[model samples]
Target chain A: MEVTASIEKERKTNLWGGGTSPLKASYGKIMMWFFLLSDAFTFSGLLITYGFLRYSYPAFSGPVSAFKPSVDYWPIPEKIFDAVPFLHGVHLPLLFVGIMTFILILSSVTMVLAVEAGQRMDRKDVTKWMLWTIVGGLAFLGCQAWEWSHFITGTEEGMALSNGVIIHGANLQVNEYGPPLFASLFFFITGFHGTHVASGVLLNVIIFYNVVVGTYDKRGHYEMVEKVGLYWHFVDLVWVFVFTFFYLI
Target chain B: MEQVVAVEVKPVDKKKVKKLWKIALILGVVTLIEFVMAFTLPRGYLLYAGFIGLTIVKAFYIVSEFMHLKHEAKALIWSIMLPTIFVIWLIVALLAEGGSILNALY
Candidate 1:
C-alpha cells in the first residue's frame, strides 16, 4: 500500500514535470541502450561474415585452399586452440578457453551483485563486488594474452599445404593452423571482443572511483553503476557468441 | 536553493542475490556442457546444431536476467527485438550470396 501510494504521487508529479523520460527510464539510460544495440549489430555483422566465409571456405577452391590446409578442408577449431597455459606444451583443447568462459561469466555475476548492491545504496558492497568484477576481467585478459602468444609461437608443426608452402604461426599473411584468412578472422574477432573487455574494465574503474568518492551517494541513486553493469554484461554476452562460433564450432 | 532532504534507502534483498547466483550457475554449467560436448560429439551437423542451440539458451538467460531486459517495458523490448530481425536477414543473405560466389568459382 505504501509503495503504491508513492508511485501514484510520482505519477502526479511526473505528469506536471516537463521532458519526461521514455518508459520512465532516464535519458542517459536510454541512450546507453541505443549505443549497445548498435554495437551489437557491429559484432553480429562480423560474426555472420565469419560464419559465411568459414562455411564456404572448403568448397571455394579459388586458389585459396590450394595454398591453405591439405586435403581441402577447413582446420578444426580444436586443432588450433588446443594449447593450455603455463604447461609449456600440452593439448588441452577448449579447456583453457572453457576456463576463460567461466571467468567472464563469473565476472558478469559479480557485476550483477555490484549493481544489486548499488540499488540498495550499499556503497561498501558495491565497491567490493565491483573489485571482484574487475579482477575477473583482468584475469580473462591475461588468459587471452597467453592464448594469443601461443598461437603466434605455434609448436613443432604447421599445417602444410599442397604446393610445398609451409606457413609458420599466425601473422597477417599466414597461420600454422590453417589459411591466412582463418587467422585474420580469429585475430579480428577475438581482438575486437578483447577491446570491449578492456574498455569495460576501464569504465568499471571510473565507476568504482565514483562509488568510493560518494558520487552516486550524493545523487541519491546508483543508476550509473547499473548502466556500466549493463555494458559489462554485454561484453560477457559477446564473448559467449565468440566462444561458440570461434572456439567451439 | 531547494531544501535538501536525505532519502531512506531500502535494505537489499537476499533473494535477489540468490537468484543472481542461480543464473550464474546455470550459465557456467551450460558452458561446461559445451566444453565436454566438443570432445565427444562427432564432427557433423548435429554437433554444430547442438552447440548453436545451447549458445542461444545462454544468450537468452544472460540478456533477460543479468541485463534485466525481461523486466523492461514491452515497447522498449520490442524495439530491440524487432531490429534483430535484420540480423537474421543479414545471415541468410550473406550465406546465400557466399554460396553462389563459391559455386561460380567451382
Candidate 2:
C-alpha cells in the first residue's frame, strides 16, 4: 500500500510543473505567454496613439511641395513601399511585406506542427518541423533587414530633411510611405516584431537541439513546442495589426 | 482486466488533432484574404475596418484553435479571455484620450 501511495504521489507531481496544463505550464511556456501579453499591450498603445495622431493632424494635402506624386496627404502606401528587390525601379506595392507576412504565418503553422508531433512522441518528426520553423523564422528576419535598410537609405535623387539633413526622407515630412508618423510607427512596430521573431528563432533552436538529444523523450512530453507556438502565433497576431495600422490605415 | 490496463497506453486524441489543423487552415485563408484586400483597397477607415476585422478574426482562430481554449472549460476560457478584454478596453480609452490630446495640441 505504501509503494502504491508513493507511486501515485510521484505521478501527481509529474503531472504538474512538467507540461502545459492546469496552470502548471512549464516555466518557459508560461513566461513566453506573459511576455507576449505584455508586448501586445505595448503594441496596442502605440497603434492607438498613432490613430489619435493621424486624426489630430491637418488633412494630408497632396505632395508637400517639390516631391510630387499624386493623391496627397500622407504618401500613398502603395507608392512608398512599392519597391521590390533585384527588380529595382519596378513599383510593386506591399509585395515584400506581404511576402514577409506569409513567411511568418507559415512559420507559425510549422511551429504548431512541431508541438503536435511532440505530443505524439515523434521525436524525428518534431526535429524536422522545428528545423523548418527555424528556417522560416530566419528568412522572415532577413526580409525585415532588407526592408529596414531600404527605409534608412534615401532614394538616388536625395532626400533632404526640414532641418536640411540629407538622409532618407522616408520619415521627416516624407516623400513616400505616408507621414513622418507613418515611417515612425512603421519602424517602432516592425522593429518590436522583428525583435520577437529573433528571440523566437533562438528559442526554437534551443528546443530543436534538446529534441535531437532526447531531452523531451527522456522527460516524456513535448510541451515546449506548444509554449513556443503560443509566442509565434502571438507574433503573427501582432503583424496583422501592424499590417493594418501601418500598411492599410 | 487489471493486467490489460497496465499494458495499454493512453491514445493520442486524433479528433482533436484534426480539429486543430482545420482551424489553422481557416486562419491562413483569412490572413490571405486580408493581404489581398490590403493591396487592392483604397486608404481610409474602410480599409482600416477590413484590416481590424481580419485581425480580430485571426486572433479568434489562434486563441480558439492553437491555444486550445475552445476545448478548455468555460472558467478557463474566461480567465484567459477576460483579461484580454480588459486590455482591449484600456487601449480604446487610451486612444480616446490621446485623440483629445492631439486636438488640444492642434
Question: Please, what are the lDDT tens digits per residue for candidate 2 over residues B22-42?
Answer: 876787788678777866765
Clashes of each: 0, 3
Show model 1 residue runs off by greater than 4 Å: A1-22, A59-71, A161-165, B1-9
In candidate 2, which residue ranges exceed 4 Å CA deviation?
Answer: A1-32, A61-73, A158-179, B1-21, B39-41, B101-106
lDDT of 1 by residue, A19-93 (tens): 444455777777888898999999999999898887666632334223334435567777667778677677677
- The global C-alpha lDDT for each of the candidates, from Candidate 1 onward, is 0.85, 0.72
Q: Model 1 residue A30 lDDT?
A: 77
lDDT of 2 by residue, A1-249 (tens): 999898777777775444336653456765666676677778777777776666655445544233333212445555577666797877677888888878877787778778878878888778888999999999999999998888867467554445675544465455344456767777777888899889989989999999897777767777877877787778777877777677765
For model 2 chain B, where is the 10-residue window of minimal lDDT?
B1-10
Q: Best candidate per lDDT, number?
A: 1
Which candidate ranks first by TM-score, i.e. highest?
Answer: 1
Worst 10 residues of 1 chain A by lDDT: A59-68
Looking at candidate 1, what is the lDDT of residue A166?
A: 65
